[model samples]
Target: MSTLLKPEAVNRPSMAAQAAESVVIVMAGADQLPVRRKGGAKPVSVDLLAALVEAALPDGFGGVSRIGFETAWEAMAPETRRALTDDLTCYLGWSASEKRQAFPADPEDLVRYLRWLEQGRGFRPATLTRRIASISRIHRMLSLSSRDTLPTRAAMVADALKAARRRRGSQQRQAAGVRLGPMMNPQDEVEGVTLAMLFSVCTSDLQGLRDGALLAVAFESGLRVSELAAIHIRDVDPQADGRGILTIGKTKTDQEGEGRYAWLSVDTMRRIGAWLEASGLEDGPLFRRVGVDRRQGRPARAPQDYFSIPGHTRHWQERLQGRPAEPPLARYAIGEGPLTRQGIGVIYKRLVRAVIDEGMVELEPGREGDLVRAISTHSMRVGLTQDLFASGEDGAGVCQAIGWRSVSTALRYVRKQSVKGGAVSRVMDGLRR
Candidate 1:
């Protein structure tokens, strides 16, 4: 069983100090501020955490021993807390359904749960691994406060997990890329959905302008969906060369708020300017939802037929009584809230479909569905990584440009292009057939 380390034994903030800081920040509504702390903003609300705990845990935080968990919660990053809570909630729900005690999970029960997740639910290895980690972490927390033991650390459970992993290989599926054309030759033909193709399908209306700017900025900055949604008008500044530089106050990799800057091409800047001008948004979220309300116009009034049925005659008479024809009109309402991550994915798919329907792009016979399924929020980020690799940029350079803290993470997206230009390919290609 994994042992719970004393919070004080680690290099964590003092419990007293963290509690005071959390209170002060919560009262001041620091999370709601657009600008953030040195690291990323602690946007997760304490109330939300408490509610999740109360609903998920068998016994709520009525006891004094569990106060340590609350204190430890304050020290965690916002994303970590959110993920753990979600994982915990899911496991607890399953435990309750199975009539099992979750705090001190049984080794046999844990193994059974793993099998259900893998076989019954058809979860991938990564998800099963994360679920195990979540159970272990929660048990560790309970061990710190209560008498719970770490059943996840049991040898039988470990062996079961190993066997399961062996049965189901651990390869992860990478999201398909929405690549721009070749970096060195920007005008070169790209087979799949390219950034240029997506732009071509974007019209001049409010929704189109917003989508264009969003895709352009996402591609240029290599921002994750959450980071893209958090972008503000105030964070972007135009440059002398007609391009612009965006100040990313915080990113998934740079949560400590040691901010980074991303370059925006002249084309991207122009699209952003058009979106901002059309939407008349000066500040707040850069990409907000544009609600479309379309009203169909009525044609010129028709003369009422005297022999018509009573209801039809009355309707026609009313229309003929000086009701003028209305023109078809579409109105766009800009929302105050930013586009959600899901909304961004939907936008990408919608535009991709549009481009295909307009004949700007084509797919192999019976392979159209595969392309659509592969495109995801990560597509833009993957495309950026691959484009950099294709342009002869090193992995480290790509990591820095894309705000990846580890070179290993960036390596995941450098497959086809990197292989084509590797040492083996170079030596063979150098000697003509």
Candidate 2:
């Protein structure tokens, strides 16, 4: 029994040790790990580059992806590539919002998205159309064919857009009627003078200067507040022989595409000169807040200081003292750069309030009369157009002066004189005679 047990147990521990050693040696024979470069940075992938391009777009709602898709689609058509590129550049430059976090997953989502943009963002009809067009372009690009109908789900959306546009046109017509609001009462032409007087009576400080200049320019040049606010020092050549040319870079219809040069009248030139001289403005934002000290009110410092940012304050102060500073003449009077739509509204409201307070224009409650009840900044443009038409200026002349690309847009501003007591019927009776 002892002999049998000893034979069975022979080399069992040695055999197990040999098996473990073989396994270890096999594991060690596997592929060696790769070595990293000493100094070279890892290159970004194409997918990442595409995503980065998408991220760089300024307009909200995956504008970059839309643009990328458009470009990729355009590559198939050599003729359209140039136009597409130009359009993309313009779109990116004008868009105010950053690219959206996500894109619409479905066509219905796109429709809803557009509606949200219109309602929440108060996108103008033109702007809404542009965004829809962009989305349509993206869809076409993704489908890899121009023949595809704009997302079927967007049909209702399209109808809604059309309806909204029609409604907007109707509302604009009604608003234009309100804006025209009866000819300056035959006897109330004196109201213009009264309005001017009201502005004069407000105060003779910086605020007053701004108010006066604004009114003078608005009345004389028939400029919208947008035009007024956008007037740069360089835009006005004071040495142009008693009449300065205003190079309007942008307007409600033009969007700063091709600038229109309009002649400024003598009175407007004088008022602008007065405002500039009194405010000591040579360059930069033309209009700025007049700082009020505890003792001195609206000091006649350079208008440049009024618009300087906090970081540039010290530099401006030094420049003001006639000392050398970084970016010379950084503290000169520069007019307000561009007036936002909201800012134009606010400025008009304030102007109307000032006019009403002074009793210059009678804004009778509930009586829609020739007197302006609630004038908006756009009223200036419309009013001026009406005045020009009434004075016998043609559509082409008005279009040229106001920076309108289309005659139809100018026609919107030119209202037909309202004939009283069925003039058409009377003409028909004459025909019978």
Candidate 3:
């Protein structure tokens, strides 16, 4: 993976910065393509863009000329480019297997595809929504280039999407929250894994120290996995009260580079300090990959006389020489690069298992897998939102705290618990008491 770009490193020429040096909009199928400096980064290849444009064209039809495709590719964010590439590739592959045209997709065929995705492939509505958006965006790009009609905008496709929504429901499955308390809502008496439970299971080992700090910081700040992984050493500011303030230079919502702040408790601060001291990291990304080397110990044995097991001979000889058996040992190697978002999710799940093993968070038999599957990289963010809502914080407060652009998005996370504190519940409680 490429090194993560620093939030404030525009002055340092990176791949993204270098790519901007060469882009020049020109006519379709121009004599020469845009050229970067000798060592500068190259744009996405024309061949791949051509293939996508080709796949998007209907039978005996051509649209989205070379320059048009190039312009669309150039305008996309790196993340969007990667996602769209995958989405289009998947659609084309599926269409080929089904022996159907993918580009300028027919409404009837599109409905069949949507059915296959939902019923046959067991895809969620959210995944279907994204796939549809990918198709729509491609069609829109083509329409802009060649004045072609948008197929995805057809009424049939809209009706198919509406039917899918009714069948599957539009509410997405949310990651389970890892609240600060055992019971996210005390009135409900619902108990689950908590940050306190996780912290209790965190050992003094290098992995434990890092996991503790990572979870603590993530929970307090309600940072998404990408933002959590991008945390640098300099982003932390210590407060006089022992708590610290974390500066988030960029977020999914705040793309303008305007920073936001979150409070970190003294406990979280101490965990961060412990991890830094143990890892001996003076700078750069705070969370990093930790490689563990474990050497297993073997029991001392007498030298083999009559028959010898091939690999056991050396161990037998050592035992005969009276040398003590090697003790089991584990050493951790810290990585220089930041932990990826996927890596952070793995760490969270591993810690969840550890907490379960330690009996800090208990579950009914056969439900362990369910709990593990429910918690994800977004668990900390979801957990923090629920915690805030349970504590009487409104939607606006949650929006501001978590840097959400809208109250509706913030409220979506706590929809289940909101009813417990609603007017009906309050009125009923008063009458009953």
Model 2 ranges with Cα > 4 A deviation: 1-105, 110-134, 137-148, 152-154, 162-169, 173-202, 218-227, 239-241, 249-258, 293-344, 364-374, 416-433
Per-residue error for 314 in candidate 1, Å, reads 2.1
The C-alpha TM-scores of every prediction are: 0.80, 0.53, 0.78
lDDT of each: 0.73, 0.49, 0.74
Pairs of residues clashing in candidate 1: 38-256, 38-257, 39-256, 39-257
For candidate 2, lDDT tens digit of each residue in 1-433?
Answer: 0100111211122554433332110111112312223542233333443454364433654344455654565343322333344333333433324333223324565556566666776765666666666555544544523544555335777776776687565334222311323344342122232344435454544445565556556654556555666677677765434656666675555543476666766666666666666566667645443322222122233334544446646566644554322221111122234434344555555555565566655555754333334455566666666655555577788767765567787666543442211357447756876
Give one clash count per candidate, in the order shown: 4, 12, 0
Supply the TM-score for candidate 3.
0.78
Ranked by TM-score from best down, the candidates are 1, 3, 2
Scored against the true structure, residue 288 in model 3 reaches a CA lDDT of 81
lDDT of 1: 0.73
lDDT tens readout by residue for model 3, 3-95: 222213111235664343332211112113222126422344646756766865666675557777788776665557766777777788778
Best by TM-score: 1
Model 1 stretches with alpha carbons more than 4 Å out: 1-67, 76-78, 143-150, 183-191, 301-312, 315-323
Per-residue lDDT over 64-91 for candidate 1, one digit per residue giving the tens place of the 0 to 100 score = 2357677767666656777777777777
Every candidate's CA RMSD: 14.3, 30.1, 12.6
